[model samples]
Target chain A: MSASDDIWILGISMTKFGKHADRDVVDLGAEAITAALADAGITMNDVGVFAAGNLMGSAGIAQQLQKQIGQTGIPAYNVSNACATGATALRTAIMAVKAGETDIGLACGVEKLAGAGLLGAGGQEKSVGHEWTPSGRYGAVGPIDGRIGTEAMPGVFAQIGMEYLHDHQYGGTAFELFARISEKNHSHSTLNPLAAYSKAMPLEQIMNDIMIAYPNTRPMCSANCDGASAAVVVSGEKLRTLSLEQQRRAVKVSASILTSDPFEQACQVLPNINTLTRNAAEQAYEQAGVGPDDLDLVELHDCFATAELVHYDNLMLCEEGGAVDFFESGAPWRDGRMPVNVSGGLQSKGHPVSATGIANIWEVCQHVRGEGGPRQIEGAKVGLAHVIGLGSACGVHILEKSGLAA
Target chain B: MSTATTIPFVDYLVLEPEPHLIAHECTGCGARYFDRRNACAGCFATEFRDVDVASDGIVRSFTIVTFAAPGVEVPFVAALVDCDGTSVRGNIVNCPPDPEHVTLGMAVRLTTVAVGADDNGVQAVNYGFEPR
Candidate 1:
């Protein structure tokens, strides 16, 4: 869809993710909000709406967060869409800007899951009803939870990989290339002080590590994390009024699209997922009047390393099945045409459910603002962020240098 | 899987006759959904008839978990099965499934096995997967 030219991302902040037994969830949020306000050189009074993306946080949690942060009378609404909670909040903020609600709004996502003692997501999840009547004999499709866990989840990836393998006759490298990709992210995590798994291992070690799912090792699985993150988004017109350096640091959200997988698109979809990813990219490019060839860096969801390869095809960074070619050529790096995951990724940064999508935007914001100290991609002009939520939903957003830059 | 005919949750909520998974074949939109939906999320069809599902499916994706919690079992498999042109996930059980014979497109049937513990020393049964 068309994004309004008025809304721009001014500043973003996130608490270092990991189990902080000492800090309460509200405390974590308070810390991030303070950091965000300071980062944007703004105060709570500038925030018109308190939009919170909290998936697992208890009810009335936003009230508690605001109380802890010293009572902002702004309206706070809680948003949840499983793991995509944060992005949903971001979406709301963008919608608010487009609707002429407020010039500046706060989009914050925080979850205090670590100390809450929940390990895996959905183990204790409330089972929403799926409408059905027992159909024919015992020869049909199974139900949910039947196809999860050990052999099941891996079975899906391995099957898809094996199919790809059978089709391309490429196996060993698929796993190896994926491992290298995972290892690179893991290594990149060390640079991110907020990332959970900072200690990186060699590809040899990752290859030898205990397998979690077939063709996937434990390292490939995103770590369960607990953290809080916040961002201050303002209208582009307002951002231009800020200091020249601040304007240079502002990142503009171009096109943000959320779509589900349509089966008819499957035939053409898998073969041309690159087209699909590029389809969204093209929309963002068109809305922002930028092109895929213009993006300097990206933060594609690397929940699993293999996903990134699929994404390369989907994002139209290369032709379908040409990810292998890009990997071997060492392109899409810091110096490559498009640097990816300059802030590590869910693979290495630790996927904190609600905070992940917002954290991704936070990373892109830092990259364009030149705050990513060591891992910074020089001359980074535009950034793209994409995340796929379950229920087969996907959202992609594009951001370019805001008005406040050096 | 219990032959009990009634599906219950937590020994408290009794889902009478147990909601069996049925798909709605939309003539208007040509979209199908497992279990009934108010309207196809894809196609808003208010009219839908229940098509009883076959309990069999091909294991599309599978995983083996070795992480054993304090009171939990390990080496169990979780998988996604495709049958009737759709996929769903559940724990894979029955014949000691060899990871090798398990192909992505391997065929299997749905087995409703007791998962958690029950009133007696018996385990509470629900739906899962077993080798076809």
Candidate 2:
């Protein structure tokens, strides 16, 4: 869609990202959706389409969510693309509006991942031992993970981080540098009251924490928690009819891009987090008509401490192989020239998987609309939100502050 | 050499002619893959040939994992080894999982390990790399 026919985010809301033992996915989903609808000053009747994202839940989260709120029976679309599920859901709604099939749309992502350990391990560790035993009809298959390197998220991201440093030869201090990146995100989380962790993690603590993988300690990993985030999108023409308050808070969707791997020779076995992310970032910049330097802030996926550093390069926030230099310059700090993950990032804000995608966009929206309180990037105009899932899907979105007057 | 009683954990690993990994090298573009592929990712070539990979490789990247799910051992070196032109993912065994023991570009050779054994006296063998 062109800039003139832009889709605007009229309202967005996120439940405080943390463990909710008492609440299920539908409970959290309904809460965020209700809050977003209220923020838009509209009811479910006004929503023309609905998209819901939940990674570890049963089928039809959108219908279940509607049952909690008002059931308008709008065309519901369920989406799940690993950690990018939320962004995928938001794009579904945005696409509906962009296609002229609807003027107003609603999207939400929710997940309950508290105490879910090591993401992809999926309780396989329980049966794992030096010698595999006959557990099922498939027979004794031992732990395939450690046996054939690792498909675990921690190991994958750790390899990706170290591989970048290896390719660049940054004076052989990958561990300390990665820890410092985690320190910045944890520090940023302190200002984000909604983050799962609001206390700043000292760099030494991050460096010394029990290592999940080399260069990535336990605290350096994204915390698994239960949370939900939702957004309301309306066509530019339809948004013009809204009240002054609604129009003032609207954030324009500059670009929405998603990408998957393009078949590289060596990256087949190892997850190529770099190529797909770079492709998405490049397309996003072209679509938005803005380079990385124009971004006032960023909320790229920091699934691991290693991930954030590489994404600096992936997002073109620095020169080729200049991620180390970018961090050294302190440009990604909360008050630095190009602030990033001011909402604690996935590292500290908590990655509820599906919730993270829209949560990242919600962070950008907060800063662009001047709604960010303590963590605000002053006079922020444009921002980017990014997330990547290892089954190999990436979503990059560019958002801008509303320029129209009531 | 593996006998009739042992089985390679993954199909790509060949146990008879020495512990080495094989790739589905695309005849069109020479792209290598461990898993079965319908077509070449690079040039969309439908034909592939079994190419035996070089046994020795350089450590392109590695991670010393200290934490994992319950029952999994810790402090193992998981590494990505570049065997000649192909990239191989496996564990670095027969050495300490530490910075002093494992560094980038360390020379290593592929080796086989007995992962598990069933009641029929058959063993499941997996491939790993060790310091050369």
Candidate 3:
């Protein structure tokens, strides 16, 4: 790998992942950014640019954050791509560094979902009792049940589960296995004091809980969390100038892939999930010269736990119908072949929308640097962080061990 | 709520023979998107043209709600109808607007129907899916 191929995460930080009604968006964003700067052992003066990620904050959130954080004169900007907003900010930072625009940059994302409290897009026309009253609607199509109207996120994904069952009879046991996966993540979250919900739930409890959607339950859905995460990315040559101690622990970003939704590929029944994720993952592997099997860990988009099962095959870690079998194999466990999530994931750790993607990246950087504490995979040299926004847009990034990026 | 005619009251009301719903399609990506778009979300193609979505499809799934929390609904079926391969989660008309009739995977069609005369004495047609 050339010197130009080198890029390392200088530092990463995140606020507690939970509903902090007392705090506002700017406070969270500033806290995460300042914490990241301190962790990187650098001052704000070292950062040449700023990329903030936010969704549904009160208008002009980017400008407001800059003023709040006192990063006034800097190139403060915001990037929005739904759930992938955070990671997209990180990508912009990486591009800036790669294009010789800056030596150090920051990608920080914050969300205040609990504050919004149901920003219902389901506005109804007033009824003076003239015509029939319709239910909450989606698009030109009026209100319908199960598809979108008030259905649980996992419940909506269950339609795919039904289709999956029809396509391949992946059974009840597969869900039980996913519960085990969640259990492992919860155990990790318990060690992570900043995590929203850290209680380790039993597999049986998840399997038998009242269904939110068929074959889906409340536990399978990622909670609508409120929090923030920040990361500092720097050129590889910059790391080389650091002390031996810092050099030993520096993590390198190998590849970053950002993409929009495919041609009318609806979230429900996304035909060729394998091809979509695999295509993106393949580009990352090729750019990084690393394969999926070589990855020490991954933080996939488990917005719905079932999607995690589906992605096992989509990421080409297993065959088409092999997710159930692979899950049953227990190879994706913390102590198993390749520990995934280990950070509780969205399932247990929580999903703060715009902040999830970068949070995943920040966790990977820590894991690769042997700083993941209890959730750390033993001898992790390569890690991947994945996020698929609204089951539409997606991104996958590969991070290498210190001094191993090409 | 009954707009039923008594003695052949077809003097002022005239129903179109070929009832159709106006919609837009992205010429760039050959995908049928109901809402209008300046660029194709699929392929980023800038070309598009107006199209009439066949008011027909199978009712994929549905639910009927009776407003009890001080709401104004006599009763209506919230139908998810798949129109000509494009599954649209919309409402169904023609029936008594009951959930039982709005069965899952039932054949349906999309068409413009004039419910009644509006305040201006002109026809007010809305797009809805109904059993074929």
Candidate 4:
């Protein structure tokens, strides 16, 4: 990529992540966009393109949101890849800027899940499409028979956890390790004012919480919340046009990669062991010219406690089946080396599906800018953000402090 | 009283005297999938043929779901059963949904059971694996 192709994150903003029953999806989205524009010190007219992502909203959400925030009639796109919706939207914006199609672009993600039923209905009036229904729903339109037709999301992860335990020979220690992860995330949340749950939760409380699925309690699962996050990115030429102060605060987008799961023998039997995440992370590291060991901080998807543990290996932060030992070594702690999820992650910050990926980006950008107050990692330079959706897809991004400004 | 007619819980199930799940195998790469595919993921081969999966297999993994869709009973055993070379996901019927009974690698045989009823009052028969 040429210097002209480089994309710089000019501004990032996120709404407080928690239940907002009164707010609708558009309201959440508009607020984030307005804030991002204000933070970038650029007006809506300066934004040449707009990209939006959400799982539940109808089509043309980007235009709808832009209409609410002064429609410049710039080209707008709506991107969706399940939980990776936010990052996908960001990737779209990066593509637009890097392609020289636009000088300034905005990527935003908003989801209103509070008070919605277990599925977090995004207020979509009609079903848009159908895929393999997990066991819970009645009408599963696939060929596999004699398969459990009613297992919900929690159950699916529980099975994964069970397989991990059985394969790693962890026995009872696996559950303990999971609780420790929850505890660590909860502790991290205490320092994150934007998190949904800022109060630290004890390991015992997490372990003893009502079991939604075997090996997973209430705290072990990411909560459904209503939130939105947005980022503004501009091309390197546009960065030169910015004020000196803004340039100093800007973060460079080193790499962004998105991938999907390949068809394998079975849904559970991932071809290369969570290949989607691994491939995305590997591509991101190569593009950024940095490996897992070089990452100063990371905000990975933790929809389930077990997912965080599995992703440790998937992201190559540790060797396969070494997540337990990694957790015990305090390597992922807020003050420890390679601190992760210091923005409280999805577990404590709440996962509003479409907003999750951008929320991860917001956290990473904060650390890279040295703006993370209480949870700030000292002298953090390189940061990574990762998110996955089970349909399924994964997105990974690497951000570094701009050397030109620093 | 209306007599309940038995129907395959899922459309792909062939509910005969000896029940077995249907799978589509790619002729080019010998890869199998429960759903129809336009192209084989392994070899990108388009040709496929229908085959019946084995009735018995070992439990690769299992979980007791405490919450599920409405009208679906909770606390049921959902498992991934390896039937011969293929892995099948289904509920473990005729066995308790506890770790003591639903251990990994436990042998299980396939059987048909009532999952629920359709709108027309026909009983939906679904297949599941049970301890052999």
Q: What is the C-alpha lDDT profile of model 2 across A1-406, one tens digit per residue?
A: 3323578999899999998999999999999999899988888999999999898989999999989998887899999899999989998998889898889999999999999888775324553234434333223256566666765789889998888887887685788989999999999999998999989988888888888998889989999999999999999999889998899889999899999999886787678899999999999999989999999999999999999999999999999999999999999998888898888888899999999888899899989998899778999999999999887899999999998883
DockQ of predictions, in order shown: 0.18, 0.52, 0.11, 0.41
Model 2, which residues run further than 4 Å from truth?
A: A1-4, A122-141, B1-3
**Candidate 1 RMSD to the real structure:** 6.4
For candidate 1, the TM-score of chain A alone versus the native chain A is 0.84
How far out, in Å, is residue A301 in model 2?
A: 0.3
TM-scores of all predicted structures: 0.78, 0.95, 0.77, 0.90
Q: What is the C-alpha lDDT of each candidate?
A: 0.65, 0.87, 0.66, 0.80
Score residue A404 of candidate 3 by CA lDDT: 36
Judge candidate 2 at residue A354 and give its lDDT: 91
Query: What digit string (tens of lDDT, one per residue) describes model 1 on residues A1-406?
Result: 1234567777789889888888766777788888888888898878877778676667766677778775668778788765567777777777776766777878777876653422332222232343222232322222222223432333334334434443454545455777887877887787888888788779988889877555567677666677888888887767767888667767777777665555541221121223345566666667777766788888887766656766776776776667777766766655577778867787778777777778888888777776778888887778888876554456678877754455
Candidate 3 chain A lDDT trough over 10 residues, lowest sum = A138-147
lDDT of 4 by residue, A120-211 (tens): 21111222343223242333433232145333566666677666666676655556677788899999999999888888999989988887
Lowest lDDT 10-residue stretch of candidate 3 chain B: B5-14
What are the clashing pairs of model 3? B55-B109, B55-B110, B56-B109, B56-B110, B57-B108
- Answer with 1 or 3, whichever has the higher lDDT: 3
- Clashing pairs for predicted structure model 2, backbone only: none
* Candidate 2 C-alpha lDDT tens digits along B57-131: 998899988877666667678898999989989999999899888988889999988876755566888889999
Give the Cα error of residue A65 in candidate 4, in Å: 1.6
lDDT (Cα, tens digit) per residue for candidate 3, span A1-406: 1235567788888888888888888899889888888888887778877888788777666677777766547787788877788988888888887877778888888897753322222333443424232222113222222212323244344344434433565436444655665666666667677778888778788767754443445666677779999888888877777667666766788898887545553333222343557677878889888888899998888876766776777676777777777777877777778777778888778888888888898888877888888767888889999987654567888987786332
Per-residue lDDT of B1-132 in model 4, one digit per residue for the tens?
A: 446466665655777766788788899987887766788888899999988888889887777767655545667787878899888778898987777788877899998876445455556677888899
Report the number of the highest-TM-score candidate: 2
Give model 1's TM-score versus the native structure.
0.78
